[model samples]
Target chain A: MTPEQEKEKEEKGEQEEQVLVLDAMKRYRNGEIWDFEDDMAVSDGHGGGENGVLLGLDGGTTSTVCICLPMVPSFSHSQLQSLPILARAVAGCSNHNSVGEIAARETLEQVMADALSKCGSKRSSVRAVCLAVSGVNHPTDQQRILNWLRDIFPSHVKLYVRNDAVAALASGTMGRLHGCVLIAGTGTIAYGFTEDGKEARAAGAGPVLGDWGSGYGIAAQALTAVVKAHDGRGPSTRLTNSILQALGLSSAEELIGWTYADPSWARIAALVPLVVSCAEAGDEVANKILLESVQELASSVKAVVERLGLSGQDGKDAFPLVMVGGVLEANRRWDIGKEVVNCISKYFPRVLPIRPKVEPAVGAAWLAWNFFMKECYS
Target chain B: MTPEQEKEKEEKGEQEEQVLVLDAMKRYRNGEIWDFEDDMAVSDGHGGGENGVLLGLDGGTTSTVCICLPMVPSFSHSQLQSLPILARAVAGCSNHNSVGEIAARETLEQVMADALSKCGSKRSSVRAVCLAVSGVNHPTDQQRILNWLRDIFPSHVKLYVRNDAVAALASGTMGRLHGCVLIAGTGTIAYGFTEDGKEARAAGAGPVLGDWGSGYGIAAQALTAVVKAHDGRGPSTRLTNSILQALGLSSAEELIGWTYADPSWARIAALVPLVVSCAEAGDEVANKILLESVQELASSVKAVVERLGLSGQDGKDAFPLVMVGGVLEANRRWDIGKEVVNCISKYFPRVLPIRPKVEPAVGAAWLAWNFFMKECYS
Candidate 1:
C-alpha cells in the first residue's frame, strides 16, 4: 500500500478505537468494570486484539505491599513514590494488632494516598490492583489482604494478593514465565517456575531455620563470631571491633546486655555486609563465614533446580537463575555475587542473571493490571 | 637342670646382686629412681627402701584438688567420699587472689607446712611431690604451681603441675603417645599427638569459637532457634517448646530475661542435650542444627589434620583420631558419634578410636618424672 493510504487507514482505525477506549476509560473511572469480559465491549484498534494477561504481586520484607498492572503504562516517578498510599489503603482494613504491622500499614496508606492525590484525575482511570506482601504466604492471609484492597477501592476493581516473593521473581525476570528467583533480604528464599507451570522452592524458612546467606544470617553469624572472638575462641575479625563500636558498647558483657535487653535482632542482622566487607579484606574468620553462607545459598538454589527437574538430561539449555534483594543488588559487582554465580552455575548450565529492574511495587502494579485485563476479557 | 639346680643358681645370683639391689630398693622407696630408666631402683625389704611411686590428682573446673601419694591401693566407697587431706591443705589458697605470684608463695608455704605435719619421722626422706592443676598452659604457670610444692617440701623434692586436658588425654589414650583425645565435661576440646611428636587440635577453643560439635554450641543454636521461632521468623522446632519447659519459661520474654539476667549463660547452655534428644526424635529443625554442628566439628578436625600434613600421599601411616569429652561419651554409641566418625574417616584413613585411659595429672607427673630423669642423667 502507498504510504499515504496506509497512514489514512491507520488514522481512521485510531479514531474508531479512541471512541471505544474513551467509553471503557469512562467505565473504569466510574468503577463499573468488574471483570475481564468488560474488554469485549471495547473495539480493538487492530482487527485482532490479544487479551492474554498475567498477574503478579510482591509483598516485600521492607516495602510491605506492591502491585503491578502490565496492561497499563508504567507508573511515573511520582506515581511510583505513591506506593505507601496503596500499601496503607490495603493494610488499613486488615485488623492487624502488632505495632510494627500497624505502623507499616499507616505508612503505606499515607504514601499511596499522597501519590493518588497528586495523580488526581488519572487515579480513577487505572484498572486492577495486584498486591504482593511479606508474611502473606498463607492462603488465608493472602485472601485477607485482597479483601482489604477490594474494601477500599470499587467493588469492580479486580485484585490479587500473593507473597512478595512472586514480585521478586517477576521483577527479576521482567515478568518472564520461567526461571528461578532468589530473594535474600532480611531473610532468604528461592522461588522458580517451569515453562510447564510447575513451581519449586527452597530455603525461605526465615532467619532461624534456613534463610542462609541472607543479611540477617550474616549478621547473626557476625555477632556469634564476635562473641567467640571475645571469649578467645575464634579468629579475630574486624567485625568484633565494628560491631562493638556500632552498638556503642565495651566488653562482651555490655554487648550481651545491649543485644538481649532490647533484642533488636534485625538491626543486628543488618551488619552482615560489614562482616562481608571485612572478609573481603582478608579477615580469615569473616571469609570463612561468608564462604559458608555462599555455599548455603548456592545449595538452596541447587535444590530448587533439582526439585523442579530443570536440569537438561541431553545437554539442553538449563533454566535461568536470577537473584533479587539488597545483597544481590549491592554486591552484583563484587566477589560475593561472582562467587554465588559461580556456585550456582555448577548445578545448571543455562543460568541467566537478571539485575532487578522493577521494584516489587511495580511488579505488583503489573499484576493488578493483568488481573483487571483477565476479568475484562474472560 | 632340675628344680634344685635352678634354685641354687638363682640363690648365687641373688647373693652376688644383694648389695646393688639393696641400694636400688632404698633409692626407689625414697622416690629418687625412675622406673623407665634402663637400670632402675628396686624395692627394699624396709618401707624406707626405694620402690615404684604413683601420684594421682583429680583437678576439676572448680578448686577441688586431690593428691594421692604412693597411689592409694584401692579407692573404697567411703575413702572416695571423704575429702583428701591435700584438698584441706590448699583450701586457704583457693580464693581468686590466691593466684599469680603472691598466691604461689602462700600456697608454697602452706604445702610445706602440710607436708611437714604429715611426714612424722620421714620428713627428710620424701623425694617427690606431684601437683595436678586445671590451667597449666604456660611454663610460668607450671613453675609457679611447682614452686609452691617445693616450698612445702625439702629442696630435693621434685615438683610437677599439668592441666586437666593432659590428664584426660593420657587416660583416654591409655598412656599412648600417638592417639587422639577428646575432653568434654563442662567444656570441650580435642587433641592428638603422633609418635614423631607432631600435634594437631580441634574444637577446644573453649566454649566459644571452635567447640562447634560440643554441647554448648548445640545449646546456643537451639536457643537461637527458640528466639527465632518465638519471633515468628523461624521454623518451629521441638527444641523451642522443650527449651521453654526446661527453663520453666512460659513465654519468650521470660526466657530472654532468665537467659541474660546474670552470669548464668552456662546454665542456658546446659539445655543443649534436650534439643539434641528432641532432634533425635525427628524434630526437623533440631536435627538440621545437630547435623550442621557435626559438619562444623568434622571440618575443624579435617583442617587440623590437613594443617599437620598428616593426610594425603606423604604420610606413611594413617593418623589415629580419638574421641574425648562428655558429649562423645554420651553420644559415642549413638548415631551422632557414628556419623562424625564416618565423616572424619572420609577425609583421613586409618583413624583409630581410643578412649583416654590416664588422667592429665598423671601425664603431668610422667612429664615431671621425665624431666627429673633427664636432669639426673645429664
Candidate 2:
C-alpha cells in the first residue's frame, strides 16, 4: 500500500478498535445505560458492513451544548443502539464580541466532557465532532473553535465548526448540496446555494441594518402603526386595539416603558401574526403593513438572486428553494410561503420548493462525518 | 323709555360714544393720530361703515391679548396710522390642564392691566375688546375664557372672545360671515361657516391627535419614511438621503440623539417640505409621502364637508373654500391647493377657490363685532 493508504487503514483500524472504557466498565459493574439506536438507523451496504459514524454539536445563541450521535451508512443497528445522545444548554454565552466566543468554547468543552461521562464514553472513542454556533462566520473564528476543540478532545478526533445558519440550511435540506433557505424567526434572512457552488444571501445583517420581514420588522411596523392610529394620522386598524391589549398598555407612555424595560425584541416580534390576522380581516392599515412586509421579503429574495447572478441561464434550475425557520414554518396558513414561492418563481422559472428534512444538529454531524470519514479512509 | 328699553338705550349710547383708550392714548402719545371725523369715511356699501367697529385680539397658545379698534368704510385704503397693535404673548399660558387655563386667565388679567396703563384712559372709555384665542370646543372651557375676560375688563367695556380659528377665517374673508378657511402653519385645521350659521371643522386636533397635511404632519411622515428606508423595510425615497443630509446624520443612531437630546418635535416636522422638494425633484419616496399628505388633507376636507351635511346641497356653492397656512401659501408651485379645490368640486359643482383676504386675527375681531352688535344686542 502507498503511504497515504497505509495511514488511512491505520486510522480506520484505530476507530474500529476504539471502545469507551467507562461504558464497558459500567456494563461490567451492571450500571444502568440509555441507548440512542432507536432514533438512528445505519445502512449496511458499505465497507464490509462496517457502520459509519457521526458526531454533531450545536452551540446556539440561547442554548449552549447539544451533542448527537447520528446513524451512518456503515454502522450496524446494534452498534447504533449502544450509543447515547446528550443535550445541555450552556448558561449565558451570548456575546457578539471576541471574549464571548472564547468563554463559549470553554463551556462547550466542559459540557461535552460531562455529556460523554454520562454516556459512558472516553474522549478517544469519538471519531469526529462538529460545532454549529452563532458568530462562527470568519475563518479566524472557525480556527479558534477548532483549536479549542482539539485542545479538549483527543488528537485522533477530528473537529469541524461553522455558523449556526449553515447548519440550519443543511438540516432543512437533509444534507442536500444545493438549495435556498429562508430563516425568519426573531430575525429574517435568506441564503441559497447553486449547484455550481455559487452562494447568495440577503437581509439578516442584524437588528440595526436589515432583517426585514422578520419578527423584529413586524413588531416595529405594528408599534409605529399604533402610534399613527393613536395620533389619528393613520388608518384605524385592528392592530391598534390588539397591540394595546397584547401589551396591556393604555397609552404611548406605557409602551415606552415596555420598550425600555428588558425589551425582548423577539417577543415583541411574535405579535406580528396578530397584525397579519387583522389584515386578513380586511383592516386597511394592517393590510398595508402586511403588503409592505411582503414587498420587503420579495425584495430580499430578488436581491439574493440578482447578487448570485442567478437571473441568467447558468443559474436557472440549478437549485431548489428551501425555507426552514420557526416563523415561516409556523405561518404556513398565512400563505407567506406561497407568496415567497410566487415571488421567486417570477425570476427563476423552474423553482422547486423543498421542505427541510433534517435537524440542524444532523447537518452538523453530517459535515463532521464527511470531514473525518475521508480522513479515516484516505 | 320703559326700564328695559332705557337700560338698552343706555348700553347702546355707552357703546357708541366710547373710544378705545389704547388707541386714543397711542395717537396722543405718538403724535400721529388723525382726527376720527376728518380721516374716517362714512359707511361703505360692502359691510364696513364709518360707525362699524371691530375689536380683534389674538390669544395664541403662547399668549393672550386684545386689539380694540373702530372700523371705517374701506379702511384698507385708509392711511390713519396707529401704535403697533396692542399685542401680548403671555408666557406660561398653555392649556394642557384646567389649572393652566385658570393661570392663563390670571395672566391675561395682568396683561390687560398693563395694556390699560399704556392706554392712559379710564377702562369705561374702551368700547370693545375682542379676544382671539386657541379655544376648547367644550362649553365650560369656552365660558371660562369669556367669563375671565369679562371679569378682567371693566363692566362697561363690551368684551368678546372666539377661537383664533374663527379670526383666521374672518381675516381671509375680510370679515365675511361665511366661508371655509384653512390654518396650516405649525398646525393645520379647517373651519368653515355655512350661510345658515352651521359650523364645520376638520383636522386641527393637535400634533398628537391629527393635524394632517400640516407642517407638523409632513415632518412626522418624512421622519418615519426615512427610518423605514434605513431598515430596508420602507420604500426608498429621496427624503431618506435629504433628511440625513439636512440633519447632518450618518445613521439612525444619530437620530436617537436628536430625539432624546433637545427633542424638538416641531423642528423635526419642519423637514417635511424638504422631503416634498425632493419628491418634486422626482424622488419616488418623496413623491409618495407628498401624495399621501395631499390625500390626507383631501380626506380631512371630505370629512368636514360630510359632517356639515353639505352633500347633495346647492348651499355648498355659497361657501367658497379658502386655503391658508404657511405650507399652502409658501408652496405655490405645488398643486396641493388646486388638488384640494378639485376634490371639493367633485362634491360641490360650484366650489369657488377664494384666497383669504384678511388675517385670522381679523376674523376674531369680526366675531367680536358680531357679538357686540348682534348676539349681545339680542
Full-model lDDT, candidate 1: 0.55
lDDT digits (tens) for residues B1-378 of candidate 1: 854575578678888799787875564444332222223223321122242232434354444333333322233322322223221233333321226555544443344334323322132334454455555555776776676555445576566565555555554443344555555544566555666767655555443233557776667677767755654435678887788888788865455446545544356557767866887788988888778867766665565665566554654456556566556556522455556677877766566656544345444344434434444445
lDDT of each: 0.55, 0.59
How well does candidate 2 score on lDDT at residue B147?
79
Residue A10's C-alpha lDDT in candidate 2? Answer: 73
Give each prediction's DockQ, rounded to 2 decimals.
0.01, 0.01
Model 2, span A14-56: residue lDDT tens: 7766656555555333422223222223332121113323456
In model 2, the runs with Cα more than 4 Å from the true position are A1-293, A308-337, A349-378, B1-84, B90-170, B173-179, B183-244, B249-264, B279-288, B311-316, B354-362
